[model samples]
Target: MIQSCLTIRGHLSKSLTTAKLINIRHAHSGIIDPLQLKPLQQEGGLLDKLISAIRRRSAPAVWKAYTDLKDSGKIKEVPIQYHSMTLQSFRLNENGYYSSDKLKFYKKCISDILVATKKAQYKLDVRDYNVLLRLYGQSRDWKAASDCWNEIKVKKNEESYNLYMQAAVQCKKYDEVFKIFNKMNNDGIQPDVTTYNTLIEANGRMGNVTEADKLFRDYFAPKNTENKSTSIISKYFIKDANLSTYTPSAAPLSRCIPPPNAVLSPTTDTFEALIDAHGRKKNTPGLNYIYKTMLPQYDIKPDLKIYNALIRWYCHSGDIEAARNTFVDMEASGIKPNVAVFNHLFRHEALKRNRPKVAEAIIDYMRKEYGIRPSTSMYATLIRIHNKHNREDEANRLHTIYKALKSKKLEEQ
Candidate 1:
């Protein structure tokens, strides 16, 4: 199943590349002289630079770029996109974690932006509100997200609902997720892949494995001739079968046929949610089935997150061999394992498995092979492990290294 899936996906990927090249050729068939183009305004150029900084996800860079543009005296008014992109820059760190200091800073930034928008008499549009919703969601500030939703109630679209649902999920307000989903249906908004992914994640995190499985099965693996009650005709569609549901605003599944341009397939995130659900329940067979059979069957390749989850599950289940094997497979598939992956394996080896040597070897391998610096906490763990094994010299050595690294980090900051 894995080979077949990879083969099919490779073919489709090549076809896409070919089509892109053809489109590029067609686009350049009539070359326009650069002299014929209108000169970009200084304000526009500054805005582009600010946007570039925002895309880099550097808070200081974003602020400097914005300040430069604002001080240039060419700006008539602040664009809503600037505010939105600025908010997006405060997203969680790469490890999917945030600090209180960051959240407080984000709140202050939002307050300043709101004041500026009011002074400029700029009305916040749905898109701006959606960005706010996303920012609040990432910060796990559900109340703030709710406020944004209320402000955009009249203009709430699919993205608005999806972001709000994500916020509720992040805050562990699982019940609110369902309520918002029901409201979305009643409001005639069709759920897209992101919406379904959030619902699945909410269900999975809440330990509603059955519901998560039902959603995946109904939406991604429906039988050809099966009659479903809850399907809608929209610009998006699911593969193999239509999404089966009976929302108040949706037509019968049997009667709804998608347009030719409609195509919605289960994404890598969809399977990640399922794997998480099974892992939460320790349903080994179910998790393996999703990773080995279902994902390949759907032509969805496993990403780094999926592999991380797999390793975590195996470690939690005391299957060290399996966890190590998954790591090997992840590397073989050309997915660069991140710090989280190494942390999982290292923790399991040093503490749970009581293989201090193996754990230290893993850390060394990570540093040498992937150039990943071990977190201070990992050093703490190693210190404890060495102490437990009556290796005071080793413990003291690691302690010195940890202190130096911590002090260096603080100084750099």
Candidate 2:
């Protein structure tokens, strides 16, 4: 009997390990593999199933598990951490504005769990609020984000306002951005670099060039202007900016902006925003000046993002040679290009110039140098390019290879 028990235990251990691997893989793909749930179910119970489902990162799977547990009256058996884990899973899964529905579903989960917490008198913490705030920001649900902001009972911090402002920017509510900034000042919360960066981006995006430039000069510019005071409040709370509508006490000379915190050095994001502003307006001279001259003067090392911006601007301005040179310089600078960079290059060369060879070279270079596997879009684009040029054999061969790789990936999952 002892030997038999040991043998069973060994098999169970292997099964559990296999199950964990499957759970992790499938969860990342946003779908739980039903076959992998057996081992976890046998070893544990509802919580284990819920955990496995959350690992799949599928909203429906998690909600199903949650509902199952709740219906079976076993939800109370699940620990608070499990609920928090679900919240965190949702928070971390936010890739961007593209996944708004999933984010809304996650928001619902948060609301349901919060109700449960309240009923059970489970004490919530700031991280919970932060995660919810991040979700709201990513979803661009300005009203929901505002509600979450106003509902925070604890002392509001810079991060809270930053998230709110981020959501407002996504909604293009530039007026709301200033209102929040003023409220932050009134609440005694000093705006940080992130605050200023988001505000600048919002203004630039709305074609409010004057606002963006004023903020840049007042805060991020290497040199200070005579008309603008160094104080944050004086610069932002001026009568002419119409920000005083939010705060009656925020007069032109109200001294609401906090004192300068040392000699402010602009972050990489500051330059990126400036460059984007110019790029959007097709102000190539201003964009080039900032990229070449202003950044070096501030001793700011240009990263891949800056390089990508320059490349994109060049591409837009019909300077393919300059864009190619910038791309080479970026690689030389030890800043590796991400898939987005490659995609930008591929799209530009293939669609704009109809030179599919450039894109094909990019594919080879990316694969050889970075060891980065071609994504589905990459394969599709290559096939399309070949077909467009009447290279039917090459297109078919690429299609076959893509299918084989996709089948293998599915098998692995």
Candidate 3:
């Protein structure tokens, strides 16, 4: 295997050496006229065919050909082609690991690809900018993505719009989502169902119910008459909330927002997800309305999954008592407490507050009523909470149980 790897490396080295010998004409600037350069046209002789191929937009075939010729030491003597097409390809390829740190790499890629396309003397096309926009979004460098967005807004691209949709999720540039939405109109880029779904999902997660509702109504529902507005007004039912309640970032709401239109009955799964999102948003009235209206009017049966969702929302919204009540309702409805439901209860009542007695009570309930043994998770949760609160005595107790369980697990293995 080592010998084969060495052989492969040697061949690549030789390929690079040959490529360096090629006399590639520096690609032109801005955009090149692939049409005017008849030699670069496909109908032309061998050289022209090569040029046309390389100039094709996002032409992996052309890129490969150029690479091959360059490796063979031919480009030094022949000219390359550039057009809007090449730029599009460059942009499309920039879609990985673009966290906040590597914004510069995305920019460099755009510039270098643009330069290559120009040297090939091809016309710049809208696709190139679209590709760049997507790359910027993948990078999660909102600032850079915003720049690409402004430049490409004149001619909208699906890739760019998609990036904005994603960037809006983790970054503070939600306006970019709307910007692309508006760009759709000016650039004649129609918003497909996917686009509307993304917008609705994003807005709902951001607690921008107004915007989410508007998008849903305009595109998803167009006829539902409901109170719709995009304000953090967490106070519809109980105005004058302690505004300073729980760290006031949209992070929780964002986390809670369901993926728009989960592939379920349009009225059931989808509405339930949105209602759960509102619960995460901590909009009491919104939660109630969804339970009262969305389920009843829509004829969606309230099932175990719905109950679990409500339990989760109540906990996430900091309504501990309500969460507990919902848990009871779920059991009364004959829904066995799944691990997830129990985990949420433990997290809220015990882990969140280091309430050991509460944790013990939950453990007793699981054993006595549910006939569920305290699994590794139960032991781990207790250990972690006790450790965090510096309750060393309690930690020792849980640690003993955890160790015994670990021993049993290993024995079974």
Clash pairs detected, candidate 1: 230-245, 230-246, 237-264
Model 2 residue 105 distance off true place after TM-score fit, in angstroms: 7.5
Q: Report model 2's TM-score to 2 decimal places.
A: 0.67
* Residue range with the least summed lDDT across 10 consecutive positions in model 2: 1-10
lDDT of each: 0.67, 0.65, 0.55
Q: Write the per-residue lDDT of candidate 1 for residues 35-140, one digit (tens) a residue.
A: 2223234446776666566646677777677667658864444443345445445444323555667677767777676775665454555545766776788778
- Give one digit per residue, the lDDT tens place, for model 3 in 1-413: 00010011111111223233222212221233343444533323445555566446424455555455546655444433233333444443321333343456446646655565555553333445556556665655677666666655344456446556666644645545555565555566655555665565556665555545444444434243444443222334343343322223323433333334432234444555466446656776667666666677657777766777777777777788877877776778687886667767777777566676797788778879887766687888878878888899989988998899789876974
RMSD of each: 11.4, 11.4, 13.7
For each candidate, what TM-score against the reference? 0.73, 0.67, 0.45
lDDT tens per residue, model 2, 1-413: 00010111111122334346334433442222332333445425776777677657666677788778878877665544455445545554323434455666777877887776665454444456667777777777778878877778866668778777778877767677777878888888888888888877876676544555556666665444335544221232223343223223222212544446564678888887777766666556666677777788789999877887877877776777777888888988989987777777777887788777778788888889998766667778878989878999989988998898788766964
Regions of model 3 farther than 4 Å from truth:
1-164, 192-194, 204-207, 217-273, 300-309, 324-341, 351-354, 360-381, 387-393, 400-413
lDDT of 1 at 56: 63
Best by lDDT: 1
Per-prediction backbone clash count:
3, 3, 30
**Model 3 Cα displacement at 178 (Å)?**
2.0
Q: What does candidate 1 score on TM?
A: 0.73
